[model samples]
Target: MNVEAPWRGNNLARQIVVLSALSFMIIAAVIGAGAFGNTAVEDQQDGALSTNGSYLAPAGPAFSIWSVIYLGLIAYAIWQALPRQRTNRRQRALGWLIALTMTLNGLWLVTARFGTLFLTVVVIVLLLAALGWTFRVAVRTREPRGGVVDSILIDGVTGLHLGWVTLATVANTAAWLTTIAPASWEKAADAIGIGVLVVVGLIGLAIAWQSSWRLTPALALAWGLSWLAVERFGGEPRSTGIGVMAIIVAAFVLLPPAVIRILRLLRPSVD
Candidate 1:
C-alpha cells in the first residue's frame, strides 16, 4: 500500500519550511556565531539570570542542551527537504508553526540583546504557544505504523522543541521580572520562580501520561531541571529547598511512563 500526502506538492509549505530554516540559522548565528557581534546567550545572562540569580535556574553547563536540540532540528530540516515529506501529514500540520517558532526564537534573541526583558518574555510565550499547537497537530495527524521517521520527525522533533521552550519561558519570565521589578520583590520573585517550576513539572507529567512516556521531551525537561537542581543545591547563592524541589520535580516528571510500562509488562498478554 502506498500513501501520498496531498500537501506534498504544495509549494507554500515548502517555502515556509525553508524560511523557518533560514530564521533558525539566524538564531544560531546570533546566539553562537556572534552575528551582529551579539554576546552568546549564556554570556548575556545579565538581563535576566545575572540580575535575578534565581535559585531555580540551572548552572551554565546545562544550557548545552541547545546544541542537541539544534541537531534534532537540523535533522528535521533535512527530512523536510525530501519531496516525499513535503506533503507529509505531520509536516503539513506542523510546518507553519515550526517556522513561527524559529521566527520567535530570533525575536527573543533580539529582545534579550537589547535588554527588553518584557518583550523577550512575550516572544517566548508566543513561541511556546506555537510549539504547543504544533504538538497538538502532530498528535492529531498521527497514523499507526508511523514508523521511525514519523516518530523522529513528528513527535521527537516537536516534543524536544516544546519541552525546551517550556523551560525557557519560565526562565525568561523570571528574568523579565527580576530585571524590571524593584528589589523589594525579591521574595515574590523566589515564590514565583518556584511556582513556575512546579507548574512546568506538572506539564511534564501531563505530557508523559498523554504520550505514555515517550522519552525525548521528558529527557529534555529533566536535563534542564537537573541543572537547576545543581545550581540551587550545590552552587553559590544556593537554596537547599529549591534545589531539592527541582530534583523532586524532575523525578516526578519522569515517573509516570516508567510506572505504566512496568504495569503493562506485568499484565498477561492476549493470545
Candidate 2:
C-alpha cells in the first residue's frame, strides 16, 4: 500500500515552524555550552582531566568529530524547516530526533568535562543507541520526494554520530575501568575495548551493506580507520596493535561493497 504523503497534506507549516524553533534552541545550547567555563574538573583518583587538554590529547581529539556531526544536524534542521519540505513525516521525525540527540550530546560533554565520567558514558551510549534507531527508521521510510537526498542526509548524520559514539563509549569505559579496577584489570579492559570496536565495526558494516544507507557508513568507516591509525602510531598505546588490526579487518570487509557502490555511482543510467 502506498503511504500518504504527509508533506502534501495539513500541518506542513506547523512542522516547519516547530523545526525552526528547535534549530534556534540547539544553536543557543551549543553557544551556552561553549561560554560556560573552561575549567578542568579534577578526578579524585587521577588528578585533573582538562576538557581542552583531554580534547587536544591523541585519544581525546577524536571527539572533535562531533563538531562536524553537529554542523550536519544544523543543516538538516534547516532543510526540514524549509516550508517546501516540512510536510514530510520522515523529515519531521528525523528533525525531532536530531534535536533530541543534539541536546543529549551537549549534556554528555558537560558531564564528562565536569568529571562525571560514568554518567557521561551512560549518556553517550544512550545517544548512540537513539541515533542508530533514528537512522534505521529513516532508511525504512518511503521518500517524500522522488530522490534519496533526505534519506541520505538523515541517515548520514545518524551514522556519523552513532559510529563515533560507539568508539567514544569504549574509550570512556576504558578510562573508568583503569581508574576503578585493579591493575590486573587494565589488561582485561583493553581486551574488552578492542572486542567492542570489532563488534561495533561489524555492526556498522552490516548496516552499510544491507541498507540504502551506504554513503554515511563509508564515510564513518573511513573516519574510524583514520583515527585508529593515529591512535596506534601517534603515541597513544591503548591496544594499538590490536586496534590497528581491527581497523584493517574492517576496512577489508567493507572495501568490496564500497567499490561496487562507487562504480554504481559512476555508471550511466540505461533509462
Candidate 3:
C-alpha cells in the first residue's frame, strides 16, 4: 500500500551520505580560495582573475558574496541530512542535482587553482549549466506542506548559485579571451563590454521569467553587476560609459522581478 515510502526512505539514506561528503568537499574548496595553503583565484593566475583582469570583472569587494553562498551550502547540507528531510519528495527530487552543483563548485575551483585559464572557463560554464538545470527543477517542484525551510535551503541556494555563476561565466569568458585575443581588441573593449552587459541583463530577465520572477537570483546578479559598475567607475582602466551601462543593466535586470514580486504580494493571485 505504501511501497513508495519505503523506497524513498532507503534511497534518501544514500543521498544524505553522498550529499554530506560533497558538501564537505565544496566547503573546503570555497575556503581554499584563500587559505589551507591555496591562493585566491585573483592571485593565482598572475592576477589575471583579478578585478582588473577583464572589463566585465566585478570589483574586489563583490567577492564577499561567496562567504554567504558558502554558508548557505553548508547549511543546506546539514538541513537535508536531518531525519525529517530524509524522505521528503522535494529533497528526493533535488538532492542529487544539488550535490552535483557542490561537486562542480569544487571542480571549478580546482581547475582555477591548477588548470589553465581555458579549463577554468570550461568548468565554470559547466557549473553554470548545472545550476541552471537545478533552478529549473526547483521551480517545477512544488514545495511540500509547510515547507518554508525547504524553500530557503534548496530553492534559495539554487537561485543564488545560478545567478552568481551566470555573471561569473561572462567574466571568465572575458578573462580567457583577454589572454588569447588580439591586443587590438582592447580598442573595441568599451563596445564589447556594453554588449556583454546587455546580454547579461537579458539572461537575467529570462531566468526571472522562467522562475516566476524569483528574487534571489535577481539579487545576486544585480549584486555582481553593481560591483562591476563600481569598478569601472572608480578603479583602474576606467570607462564611464561602461560604468553607466552596468548600472543601467543592473537596474534593468533587477527591477522587473522585484516589481512582479511586489505585485504578487499585494494581489496574492497575480500569477
Candidate 4:
C-alpha cells in the first residue's frame, strides 16, 4: 500500500474533478436527447439562436466546440485520477474551480431549458469567471520536466474551455439583449452588437496572451466567429457587413498568438 500512497493521497481533489466530469456528461446527454428542445416557454437552444436570436450567435456547427471541450474534460478527469497527478500542484489548484465550472455549466443548460434567458446569461457569466480563475491558477502552477500529459489534459483543454466560454458569455448576453432591447433599437442594434463582439474579443485576446500563448482559445473563438460570419454573410438574415466584421474579429483574435508563436520560433538561439 505504501507504493499507492501518493496516488491515493489526493483523493479529495481527484474526486472533485471526476464528479465534475460526470456532471458534464449528464447534461451533455440531456442536450443530445433534445429534452430541452421546444419547451413550454423557449425553443431549443439552436432554434432560439437563429438569425433573429442574436447577430452574435454563431451557426449551429460552432457548437461542436462543446464536443471538443467535453472530451478534453473527460481526459482531464482521467488524467487527474492517475497516480502521477494525485499530488500534482496544478491539478490541485484547479480542482474546486473545475467543480464550480461543471456546476455552472449544468445550471446554464437548466436555465436555458426553462426559457430563462436572463438567468442563462448569468450562469454562463459565472461559469466564465470560474474558468478564468482556473486559467490564472494554471498559468502560475509549475510543471515537472516532462509536462506532455498535463499539457494535453489540463492547460490545453482548460484554455479552450475558457476561450469558448468567453465568447459564449457575450453571445448569451446578446440573446438576452434581444429580449429586452426596445423594438426601436432595431436600426442601430447591428452596430452595437458587432461592437460588443469586438470589444470582448480583444479582451479575450489579452487574457489568453497573458495566460498562455496556446492557440486553443483562439481556435475556439475563431471557430465560433468563422461560423457567425458564414451565418451572417449568406445563410440567414444575411448581412455582408456583420459577416465581414466577424471574419475580421476572428482574424484579429487569432493573429496575436500566431504571431507570438512565430516570433518565438524565429528568435535566435544561444548555443
Best of the two (1, 2) by TM-score: 1
- Give the clashing pairs for model 1: 7-87, 8-87
Task: Give, for candidate 4, the lowest lDDT window spanning 10 residues.
Answer: 38-47
lDDT of 3 at 13: 69
Cα RMSD for candidates in order: 4.0, 5.3, 2.1, 3.6
By lDDT, is 3 or 4 better? Answer: 3
* TM, every model: 0.83, 0.74, 0.93, 0.86
* Model 3, span 1-23: residue lDDT tens: 88788777676765766577576
Candidate 2 runs further than 4 Å off: 1-36, 40-61, 146-152, 188-190, 253-256, 266-271
Worst 10 residues of 3 by lDDT: 23-32
Least accurate stretch of 10 residues (summed lDDT) in model 2? 48-57
lDDT ranking of the models: 3, 4, 1, 2
Q: Give the number of the best model, judged by TM-score.
A: 3
Report the number of the highest-lDDT candidate.
3
For model 2, how does the per-residue alpha-carbon lDDT over 120-209 read when each residue is reduced to its tens digit? 668778877777777776777665532566655677777777766665655555565445667675556446655666676677667776
TM-score of 4: 0.86
Ranking by TM-score: 3, 4, 1, 2
Per-residue error for 160 in candidate 2, Å, reads: 1.9
Query: In model 4, how many backbone clashes occur?
Result: 0
What Cα-based lDDT does every candidate model obtain? Answer: 0.69, 0.59, 0.85, 0.73
Per-residue lDDT over 122-187 for candidate 1, one digit per residue giving the tens place of the 0 to 100 score: 888988888877776676664442478877866887788787777777776766665667878765
